[model samples]
Structures are given as C-alpha cells and as structure tokens.
Target: MKKSLLLLIAFSLMVMGTQVQAAGQDIRLVVDISGSMNRTDPNNLRIPTANMLADLLPDGSEAGVWTFAREVNMLVKHGLVNDAWRDQVQEEAEKINSVGLYTHIDHAIETVTWDADWDVDKDRHLILLSDGLVDLSQADTQEERSRENQASRDHLLRERLPQLVDAGYTLHTLALSDEADQDLMATLAQRSGGLHAIAYEADDLMPLLLQILNRVVDSEQVPLEGNEFSIDPLINEFTALVFHQPDAEMVLHSPSGESYTRESDQSNLNWHGNARYTLVTVKEPEAGDWQIETPAHPDNRITVVSDLKLHTSSFPATVYRGFPDKEQTLKAWFTEEGQRIDRREFLRLLDAQMQHHQDDLLLTEKNMPFAEDNLDFRASLTDFDELGEQQVTVLVDGHTFQRQVTHSFNVQDVVAANLQLPENGGTPKIVLRAQHPQLDPDQVDFQVTANGEAQPIDYRGDGEWQVDLANLEPGREYLLEVEAEGKLKGERLNLVLPSMRLEEGSVRALDRQPEEPQETEESQQTPPDFVPNIAPQVIPSPVLPTPSASQTEEASEEEQQPAQSEEESDPPVDDETADEEGLFEMDFSPIKSWDDPRMLWVYVALGLANILLFTLAFILYRRFIRRRKERHDAQVHDDEDTPEIDDLEFDLDDELDPGK
Candidate 1:
C-alpha cells in the first residue's frame, strides 16, 4: 500500500512537471508590409522567411503574425503551431505583397507588446523583422510630418521598449537591409536580454530566424575527439562548427556520397582566425548522418553548437540591493545539445566571467542535486552596497563558441515613492515619503496642474508640498507631476514620478452626456378623448316602457276574438294615428324608483337565496362536528381494546419440553 501511494504521488508530480514545461511558448512575429519592401527586397523574401519560421518552430508553440503599414492587421491570431496553422499562416503571409504605403513601426511594437494576448507565466518572445524605415506620415505635407514621425518612433524606442523589457518579454530584432536602424535594434535586444542579428541580403534572413527559433526551442553540444565524427541533423539548414585546430585537414561527406574537402569546395566553409575554426553551413541538409574526418589531433575537441539557451534563477531585474557585507547568490546555467552540463571543471574550462562596474567578480559553481536537469552555478557578490545602475557580464571563452550575455540591475536606495493626498477640501496638500535610507527629502519636487493649467506650489518642510487650488474650479481633474532629483553612487538621478489625477469627488463624471430621445409633433398632440374641449359627448338612447301583463293579454285575445264591423275598426284608426304621434315623441325623464311588482319579486328571490345559503352552511358545520366526534370516540375505543404486551407471561419450561 505504501509503495502504491508513493508511486501515485510520483506520477502526479511528473504530470504536473510536464504541464509546467508544456505551458507552451507565445511568439509574436511583427512583419513590415510597407511598399518600400517591394523595392528593397525585390524577391519578396518576407513570405518565405515567415514560412521558414513556421516550419522551424516547435509543435504546440502558439504564435501570432502581425503586419503593419499604415495600420496593423493580424494575419494569424495566436494559436497552436499545428500543420493546419502553418498552412494558414503561410497563406496569409503570401497575401502580404507590400501594398501598403506607410510604415508604422511604433504602432506595430505598441500593438504587439500591449494588445497581443500574452501568457504571463509562459515564455513570451517578440520577433520583429523590419527595415526600420518608420514612416508615420499621413498628412498632405512631407517634411514636417517626417520629423514628427521620426520623433514619435524615437520616443517609442526609448520609453516603450524598457517597459516591455521590465514586463519580462524578450524581443529579438532582425535588420533586413543596410538602411535598417542598427542602433535601435541593438538597444531593444540588449535591454530585453535577447539576441540581435543582421541580414545583409535576403538569403541571410532564413538562417538568422532559424538561430532564434533554435534558441527558443532547445540547444545541445557534442564534444568531438576522434578522427571521424558524424552528426545527424533532423532539420534542414543546420549550422555546424569545428573549433580549436588551425592546421588540421578536414573533409566532409554528404549523405548522397558527395565529398567536400578543404581543397575541393570551400564556398560553404568559413574560417575564423587563420583557419583556427571552421563553420559549416548546410542548406537543406539530408536526413541521414554526415561524417567529418580530421586527420591531425584526435584529442582536440569539436563542439557542435545546436542551440544556445541561457537559464538563470534570478534575472537582473529581480536582483535587489543589500548591505555592504551582505552576500547574495546569482545562479545561472546554459544548455547545449539539449543536455545540462553541471560539471565544475567543464564550466571552469569555458572561462565564464562575471563583472560589475569594471571589476571582475569571482563565481564558484554551486551543486544543486534537486535540479538534475538544470546546470546550476552560483556567484557571490559582497560589495552591492554602492547603489544605482549596476551591471554584470557573463561570457564564454572561444570566439567561435563564445556566448556574450550581459544583464543590468538598478540598485537604488529607494525602491518606491509614497505620495499622500489631502482628504478635505482647501489648498491641496501632498505628503511625499521616501522608502530608502539614502533618499533626501528636499530633492523631491511636486507640481500640480488643474486641467492642464499649472497651479502655485508651496513646499512645506519634511517632504511635504502644498498646492494652492483655492482658485481652481471644483469637479475638474487636476494632475500631479512629481520630479525627484538626487545623486546616488556618484551618478546623477533625475526621475519622473508617475502622474496622478485628482478630482473633487471620489469618482469623476464622464466626459460626454448620453443623448436624449427627441419629441415629435405627432407625439405631442393629445387624443380627443384625453382633451375635455375636443371630446365627443355620447347621448344614450331612451329606455322603452315595459308593457303590463294585462295589456299584453288583451292584445293577444283581441287577435283571437271575432273581428268587429268596419265602423268599429275605423274608430281605432284615429287612435292608431295618435299612437303613431306618441311613438315619434320620446320621453326624456330620469328613473326615480323601481316600484314594479317584477322588481319586488326579484328582491324576494335574492332574500330567499341568502337564507338558503345560510341553512346549507349550518348543515355542513353540523355534519363536520358529528363526524369529528365519531372519529374521537373510535380512537378512544381502539385505545381501550388494545391490551399491553408486558402484562402477558409465557411458560418457557413447558414450551421447551413440547419442542423436545
């Protein structure tokens, strides 16, 4: 049972670890689709480059493609890198034929950095491929618009790129042409701890992209010592290099039995430092293993660089300043050929250097048995007391196999600034507090503005500033801008604090009011029934007089009686004319009382119905009482007839004898 429980726990942990590693990668490919690409590229290399990138990316990695000219359009939303996604991305990429007129590089960067769907805990990368010719002109004029656009692009690079870096997104830049902005690209890459590479022509783009993808996916290194070394590249366009022997003769054989020696085909082979190292470039290499033969120096190592990946436990942004004697550990590792090399002597042979402020700091390898798959090394820094803009560099030894990585940390005495606003209405008072020991109270300057207009600021003692907002209008927004200038570690510091807005009330009103419904002429007109003057008065018809029973009987009997003489009938004609005259005149009189015998009979019937209802109700109540009494009597009888079981006794001895 214990073993089974342990196995179950281990399985759960393994599944969890797989889930953590398989959180997948998010990569945004921001491509330039301006009209200039048509003239500069001519061959339409961007589409093919995107295709190569999609093919090279690891399966299940989510990627999004964005193209920016006048505006940015998403070709492929972030999705898993399946075969269908690859095909879809390739199709959309083909549609980008450089038709747009303007290049909005700033807009593209802002959209990808802020608007793109990013998984915060997962590995996120932004691969920007542009000519860096940012043209944001949308007006009729040219020169003035160009200047504004250039300034906007410069501001984006200076401000937004740092924010992206601080948010922990690595941005890799690829400059496609000689006219591309190299300085901006390098700055972006360096600040974000990403690699920056240049492509002089269209052909160099694919390899540069492949290198980036490899860094994101996996990296490995294989040491070669024998006369014959073979390497199997599963993917096409694999880069291989053999280093540390200048005079060694080398021969390479393709899988198709084509041989390439130092003297035969030297086009693909590039030598560094007088044939000290050779870099072999294989374009669309075969699937089978390729052999490399070196005659001299069998012990000399040939390091096969597959992918270059740097993993650190604590990044530069995470490092904090401590006391002068306080010791802090910096752990880092590098992966090559998908394997972790934690050997101390092997790491020492690489000659890794860690420097801070032009001083080389010594780093010792730290063994981490719990992390078997990660190569862990630690460096101790004792003098972190000097604060403000500290940087460290880590690099390997050889030129061909060397990796130069630098990370910067801002060591400040004050980590954050605290600002307190007044609660009541009056001249607004703001209290500025510094959280660090070295921060001076007098160096901070606070300026308040109401609706873009500056207000008078009165500086009180001990980091407090009072702004006279007495003349300022209420129910309006006021902005507070704070500037803190101080000196730390012999470096001048000018910091612009976060802008804060204050309104008269806790919640500010919306800028615009909701539109109200309009009243039409037809709606305003009231109906004739609703208006007293125009209302039609309805006159009711007169009620007909009911005939007496005797009169009705006399009329029926007269019809059955024998007819009188013509003279007797003629006497009734005058009476009939009088009846006709009476019928033409209607009696207009109010009904006073109902004194007819039929009305008396109706009142008598209603009284009889009320008495009948009362008698029926009385009968039902009597029946209910009688039934309830009978049920009570029956219950009493049942209780009396039921005998108690406790009173009855059994003869156990007699019963036992009868069974035997």
Candidate 2:
C-alpha cells in the first residue's frame, strides 16, 4: 500500500512539472493583405510561404491562419494539426490577396485571440506580418480615420500587449517593406519576448519565415556541410528545404549512390517544388550519408523527426550594451523525450560550434565545449561590438547525425560618450554624442558626482561638458559617476555612465584601460565605445570600480603575470564577480511573494490541494485494504467459534454411554 501511494504521488508531481515547462508549441499566423502589399509583394510569395510553414508544422501541434485588410477573416481555424488541417490551409492560402482597401490589424488580432483558451497545454506564439501601418475604414473623414488608427494602435500597445505577455503569448512580427510600421512591430516583439524581422524585398519572406520556424518548433536537424548530410538509425523521418536558382533543379543522392529527383517514382518520398525553393520529405530514410546537388544557399537546411533532439537556451532578441544583469549566455544539450542525456559515451562523440553572422558576412565562430560533468555545452558571447542584427547558428556535429539551431538578436548602444581625461594634469572634459538619431541632445542633462558628492557641470556648445576640478585636491583618487537624462523619441531615457578614476590630475574610465595599444588613429576617429547613460536616454552602467591599492600590490607580487591587452587590462566586472566582490548591484524584483495578497492566496490554495491529495490517497488505501483485512479476520473468527471434530469425540462417548 505504501509503495502504491508513493508511486501515485510521484506521478502527480511529474504531471505538475510537465505543466510548468509547457508542452508542444502552438503557432498562429496573422497576415496583412493591405492594398500597399500590391507593390511590396507583387509576386504573391506569401501564399507559398504560408503553405510551406503549414507543411513544416509537425503533427499534433496546433496552428491557425488569419488574414486582415478591412475585415478580419480566418483562413484556417485554430485546432490540433493533422493532414486534413494542412491541406485546408494550403487550399485557403490561395485566397490571400492585396485587394482590401485598409489594414485592420487591431480587429484581426482581437478576433483571433477572442476565444483563445490560454489554459491549453502548449507554448503559444503569434506570427504577425504586415506591409503597411494600421488603417481602418470606419471613419468618414481623413482626420477621423487618422485619429481612429492612432487610438487603435494605442489600445493594442497599452492593453493587448500586456495581456498577451501575462498569458504567455510571444508575437513574432515581420515588416514586409520600408513603408511597414517597423517600430510598432519591434515594440510588440520586444515586449512579448518574441522576434521581429524586416523583409527588404518580397522574396525575402520565405527565408525569414523559415528562420522564425527554427525558433518556434523543437525539431532536431542533420547538419548539411557542402550540400551533404548524414542520417542515423534514430531518425524516423527527415525533410530538406533547399533553395536554388529559379530554373535550376535539385537532385538528392542516397548513400548507395542512387540519385532521385522530383520525377523519381519513390513511394516514401514527398517532393514540393516552388518558386526559388524546393522542399522534400523522405520517410523511413536509409541510415547513411545523403547529398543534395544544387546551388549553395546559406538558408538551405534539413530537419528531422527523432526522439533524440538538441535543445538550446533561448537567446535574447535584443542585447543592451550597458546592462550587466542582462548579459547573454548560450547553452545547448541533448535530450531524449523530456529528459536530458547525460551518458558520457554518447556525448564524447559529439562536437558543437556557433557561427555568428552579420548580414552576408561571417563575424566570428565559437566552439562550445562540454561542461566538466560532460552533460551539456555552453558558450559566453562577449564579442558583440558589431551593432546590428546578429544571427548565431549553433551546430552540433556527430559521426552519424548532426543538429543545428539559429538565433538572432540586435546590439544597441544606450549612450555614446568619450571621457577626455588629460594625462598631463589638465582639465577633464567629456564629449557626449547621441548614438541613436532620435535622441534630442539639447534637452539632455547630466548629474555628475565626485566621491559620492555632486559636482557642477559646465555645458559647452555641441555636446561637450567641462568638469571644474579647481577645488579638488591633487593626487587624491576620485571616483566620478555621471548620469545623463534626455528625451529619446518623446520618452525619458535614464543612462548610467561608466565610473572614472581621477588622480594626479589625470582621469580614466574605470571600465576601460588607461592606454590602448591596438587603438589606431583611424579607429579612434570613429565614435568611442559607448558608455551606459540613463535619465530618459540610453547608456550602459559600470559595475567595476577603480583598482584599490591592495589589488595593485597583489598584481606586483605576482612574478609570472601575463601581459594585459586593451581588452584584458580593466574590463567591466560581470554580475557574478560584482556580487562576490560587493562592489555594485543590479536591480531585480519578484512580483509574487509573502508580501502580495494574490501570492498568499495562491500559496494557501496549493497547500490545501496538497493536503487534499494526501488525505484522499490515505482514505483510498485504508478503505480498500482495511475492508479486505476485516473480511479475512471475520472468516477466521467464525471458524474458531464453530466446535471442532476433536471436541465432538467426548459427545460421541456420551452418546455411546446413553445420555449421561
């Protein structure tokens, strides 16, 4: 009874754990058919893109499609996916066109999510594609129309976005052209922890959609190198999406040297040839090497359905330059079903690498090594100097199979300032420039502090500030902190600048070194490395302080000290080290705890649930087992109460002696 009860309780806990992680992923497509799309998407590439995404969506996952113009219409009803659902979506995709007079994005989103059951066991996602700003046809006058559109946008941002965030709905947005509302799309994605991409041309839609799918689904991949990949025994089915020239044909070669094409009479193959791309799926594929003969394209990929999969940490969509608490770290591991794979023999055979890309250029590559326990792989991304869209593709290579996943993020500077500290004991001046074009420089104000006391700043023309050090003592080290406040795109930006060390009439930024050997005259001509500034504007804050006398003494005592390079000399301390050294702090807050009434109620409800479950389990065991025991005891007692045959012997003697 105890063992059974233990098993039942274990099963209940497992179910709760699975719910916490969520289950399969669900995606909803919301497309714009605004009249402007007639010029942006002249080829009607969205039809095929939608069809392809439907094909790629695995079975048992939930998906739906909706298109909006003046009216919101459902192309595919949201439900669990199957062969029928995919076919319906393909049939319905043909109806998508840029004939509508207006774009009713607000109405479309509301209708799609009006009856959404958020309690479903799935990770919800919404892919919103647009080629124009929000427009509605309900107003008679042009001014009324503009007013209504702005109101609708405000409602979507202020009300709808917060609800979606609370309900765990990630919104991946795509801007189909320059005329599209890119800022709104970016805001929605960023606020919801989703992805946003710009399709410079209509033809770019398919590849961007594929990249988004790479993040949406949990599918393992077989890495393709030079158009070749290997399949393993564990693979049940594999699909390859290959991009080729408009007139070029793609050929697939199996390990046995057998070549197949779209014309091949293979019962286990499904081939789809579309404009600029071809998708092929092979079932029960042979477990060996396979190659595709086609023009090389970076977006070409192969995804497989298997029990063994590669899972990775969700990289941030945006990386802030000066936030130490928001540092980016990437991790990957193998999993079978829902559990992590820890067997060393299997892990030792695999190698992992991350490829960093900026547009058509490959910025760098990083090798991900297994942890000391040899259970997973991890890599810290420190080389983010490139300030633009960065796509990181992680590839795990093995003898028979491989896995790959791509993530993209943008690097943005919060503030751009250069501290011109004199080496010859002169005046300390700051040349502060706005990195973001939207920042209003004239309105920016600074709060300067020297040794925890406020200092007066003399603002000079053209983004220059002169710090008066006449009253300050010479040769005494001073810790200087600068805070900038400004109007950025009509919003207040608070920026925290890196601290500076001023001593002996010289000043240097503590987060950086006093001298840079690799900094060339030409490189210095460009903007300085951005420092965090806040107060209704952007800039990264510093966590490191100037080296103390004790640290300098320890550095001198070390006999075999390595040479300090420009980057290594005095880098800003990470959050972990900052906590250990107790130098600075990063602010974080929890929404729920003992202090919140809602949290207290939630905890009380959970405690009551646990008690109820325990009581129910105890009653079930006792009721059944105790009843069975009682029945057995009653039978034994009845047998004892009845006279035995040995006792009847005396009666037999009495009967023989004639009724004594």
Candidate 3:
C-alpha cells in the first residue's frame, strides 16, 4: 500500500509540475497456440514454459499479445504489465479460435513485421512457446488449410528461419516436445535476440516464465519517451493493442454527461481501458501498430463501436421468407440457420443476390396469380440449403434450363431474359439467351410451349436461342423450359405482374425474430387507402451539446429521440404497400458523427458472424472429407506436424457508431 501510494504521488507530481519526463518499455508477447503445444511437452509439461514463464514477468510491465497458429492473432496492446487482470486475459486466450492446419512461422514473423508500428530499438520480444516442429506441408497463399505437399519443412526451417531474427524480433522458443528442433530454437534465439529454453512439462513452465520476466525487468534501461494519459474507467475500453502511435491524444467526448480529457504524459504514451468500457475517443495519430483501444470494445479495438450501435451492412440479396412482411423486413438472417439472430443487435446486411441471375438472360416473365401490385420478373432461383447432397442446381423455364449454382454465399446469381410473346402464340417465336461468364452457354437447351403443346427451339443466339410458335392465348399460362444437360435446368413460367410494395407499420419491431412461417389468408390485408408518401429529405443530425461530467443523471433512448413512432403505431399495413408506408417523421437529426469505440459492437458482431460462418463451413467440409477418405482407398496423410489456423481480425463500421 505504501509503495502504491508513493508511486501514485510520484505519478501525480509528474503530471502536475515536474520535468514531465516519459520513459517506459512497451513489450508485446506473441504466443504460439497450436495443437502440438496442447500435447504433453517433454517432462510431462502441461503447457510447457508458458504459464511458468508468465509468472516471472514484471508486474505492471507494458505488454501486448499475439497468438500464432496457421496465422497470427494479436490479443493485447503494448502497454503496462497486468497481473491482477490476467484471469480474463487467460480466459480469452484459451478461447482463441484455432484449427490445426499448417503453421507458418515465417508467415507469423512476416505478419508482425507488417504490423510493426512501434520502436524496433525498444524491448520488443516474441515469446514463442511451441513444439518446435515446423509445418512445411500446406500453402497459405489463399486462406484455409490446403493439402500438404511440401516435404522439405525441416530444410526450409534450416535455411529460412534466420530471416526473422534479422527483423529485430527476439525469439524465445520453449521446446516442449522431443520431436521439436532444439537447434532451430537456439538459432531463433540467437537471430532474434531471444533466449532458447527447455520447458518439458507443466511444472517446467515456471522457470521459462521467470526467465522472460527477468529479461524484461532486469534490463531496466528501456525508456519510453512520450506522454501519459488515461480515459475514464467505463467509457475507455481496450485491453490489447490492434494498432497505435506515439504523441496521440484520445479525447473522450462525454456522452451526454460523462466528459473526459486526457493529456499525454512522459510515461504513458497510450491509454489502456479494460473491464466494462463505456468511453468514446477522438484519436489524433494515424499511424502505428499500437493504436488507441477502447475498454468497452476490446475485441473491436477501435473507436467506431462507441459511435455506432448494433450496426452491420450486408451485400444486397433478395431474401426469401415464408411470410411477405418478413421478406421485406430488411432484417439479416443467418443463411445456414435463419432463426439464429441476436435481437440485441442492429444488422446491416446486403441484399445482393439479384445481379448474378439477372445478367445471364435467365429471368423470364413468370406470372403470379395476383400481378396487379407487383413489378418483378424472375428467371431462376434455387435453394442450396435444402437441395440435398448435390451442391449445384439450375433454374428452369420448363424445357430450357439455365444452370446456376452458388455453393458459397460470396457469389450471387442474377439471370435476365428478354423474349416477346406474339398474340397467336402456339409457341410464340421464342428466343433463349444465356449471358453468364461462369456458365457454359453451349450446355443450354430450349423447350417452349405457349398453350399446352411443347415445341423444340432453334439457336439464333450468339447467346440466345429461338423457337417458333403457332398460336397463343392472351391470359392463358405459358411454360418456358430451360434444360442444360449436365450444366443446368429450370422452368420460367410467364407472369405479367405489377410492382409490389410493403405496408406501413405492418409488423411490430423486435430486437430479434425467428424465420417466418407460412402466411395464412387472414394474415393478408387490404392496402390502406393512404396517400402516396412524399420521400422526406434526410438532414444529418447536428452535433449535440456535450453533457458536463457534473451532470449525475442523463436521459434514456426515448427521452433523447422522439417516441412518436411507437406512440402512433397504427394498424399493420398490407404487404403490397409496405415499402411506401411512412414510419418515422422523415426529418434527419443533425449531429456530428464523432466515433465511439463502444458502438463498434455492431460491426464486430457482423464480422464475427461472417467468420463464424466460414469456420463452420470449413469444419463441416473437413468432417465430410474425412468421412469420404475413410471409405475410399486414398492416402489420407494425417501427419502430426500440422500447424494451426489463426482467426481473422475483428473490424467495426456500423455496429460501433451509427454516425461513423
């Protein structure tokens, strides 16, 4: 307590009127989290020298974190050492998403080099705890674990390992397994200015931890000549460093009543906010690896979260729902599991699935029973989730099929069609066209029928096919079949319909909802005899007057914004005019879009969703592949030397600050 009091007094004195000196070491730890490390190291070590080595670091020493598997992951920032808050750090570390793919130590080294925004002359060390078994099997040119083809892993490590040392990162390898290369560990140590050690078992880890601690604490002369600062407790959020720079002042523009100003000092060049972060920031520096981190949004590692709220934007795609209202909700649904939506979040997903299908000349006139209020002509559509084992499928217009399939969500198909129907249409002169770059146009075949009888079609297309019809019925149904043998197939029935719109206030808004079920007739409503709504001009909200810190209490969401939208909730509008219904009074709030890292959750949630999806897909794919290999007489190389895949970084845009 006395030591702490003295330290505080000294710190205060420095802040008040001393030489205002700045000097401290900003150390970062780059850990290796691979499958091999989990295996019992030599001497029955649980996690080799990791935990033991951790115990030796100077308490409250400046540090950042990075984890490596197939890729590299930064866990914390280069700041002060924290022993008391380690439990949370350890928990987060344990949860690091990793898959045993193939670890590229060289790649990890390259990654740190790319993110090197701090002083290379300072005490920068890479405390690499690994089995020392190099993975030279797969290539990481494209993300994910590729097939293991490189057999010269040992030789590569021998010839290529020294480059990382030249990059000024001290490599302290904790050899955990007998299969690990001690020579390489020593070489890494010598090259990177790191010490090589042997941590065989769980108990053996302590010495290594202490060794690192001694190196950091004893060297003692590492001086960080910069300013010191601290953001308010709640508003400030950031435990680790994603990126940063020196001489940066992160102004925390108080939200309503919580204003904070932090001036840089000699010892503290960056601000560290953890626990329950409630702060926002105004960052001045634009370059470096140790950027400002908000406590409220550590995973996001940015100020935008504090600005935006539960926000995310997705590519445009026509979402199908069992209910009409749900289809036009603009709500993002999980493609694999539509029902799994986080109600607390505000999603901004795109509706981008139309362009792909619209361009291929696949969309033909499909007649809806009620075309009076609809203006949509679709060519082809297929549901992959329910399409059984075959990954690919085609959209058809009866006999003429234009094959279109997207196994990944990244690709959206748009099919377009332009054909004229003659009044005497037996098979009115039909012309089929295919215009997709990814598609084989020759595989497309055409079958047309105007009134019950089907007729063969001729190719009049550079990309189009033609068919001659004898007689046609005006309001009678006509079928257009597009069949592509081994390529694609689907039917496009003609439907002349008017454009449709959604009703105003048709459904209650909730934070989250399940996928819509089948809509009943009674659920359908007559379009309200409302006047056509004039599109309101959106004026950005103005910068709000900041609340002084002295203001103890503040307003709620309702008090701040007009609650008239809910107060005047009228009867649900019909689906036909839902799009045109007036909801909120269309005046824009004019406020400066200053950032709040806390709001980064919106974007973080969005990015996490994307990553989780990819990870899930990869896992399922691996499982199916393994099952197939089990049955086939194939060489399944399940080598023990496979490394791990590092999770992608989290970014924020919408979820953080809406203004941002």
Give the number of the best model, judged by lDDT. 2
Kindly list the per-residue Cα lDDT of model 3 for residues 1-660, writing each as its tens digit: 999999999999977542222234445556666554444332333222233223334454555566776667766544455665444454455444323344556666656555355444454566666553444333222111112312233333444444544444555565653334443454455445455555544444543444444344432111111321222322222222221222333443323433243444423224443222212234432122232332222112222111111111221112211111212111112211224334322222212122222212333232212112221112223332120011111111211111111211111111222232211111223344342322345654444443346766666423445554333332333444333322433322222211111112111112222122221111111111121121111111011011001000122222221112221223346887766664543334332222423235558999999999999999998996565444332223434343222211111322352432
Model 1, 302-395: lDDT tens digits are 2333454444544333233432323555566766556766666556555445555511233332232222344454566556555333445444
How does candidate 3 score on lDDT?
Answer: 0.35
Best-matching candidate per TM-score:
2
Candidate 2: TM-score?
Answer: 0.60
Runs in model 3 deviating more than 4 A are 1-23, 41-56, 83-87, 96-99, 113-121, 139-168, 219-660
Task: Return whichever of 2 and 3 wins on TM-score.
Answer: 2
lDDT of 2 by residue, 1-660 (tens): 999999999999999877754577789999888656667788898998899888888887789999997688889898878889988987999999977756667788888777454676667889999876666634433345455766777678778877887778888888786445555666677777777778878888988887678668766677788799889988889999998877688999999999999999999999985767888999999988999998778888888988888888888776656433435678889889768888988887889998888867988788998885758888877676665456887899886777887886766555544554321122344444443433456777888887988877776433335555445544456787888886665666677877776544234567765332122111111111221111111121111001001111112223211221222212256787866754453223333223433455568999999999999999998886565555544555775666556445444544454423
TM for every model, in the order presented, reads: 0.39, 0.60, 0.27
Give the worst 10-residue stretch by lDDT in candidate 3: 543-552
Q: Whole-model lDDT for model 2 versus the true structure?
A: 0.68
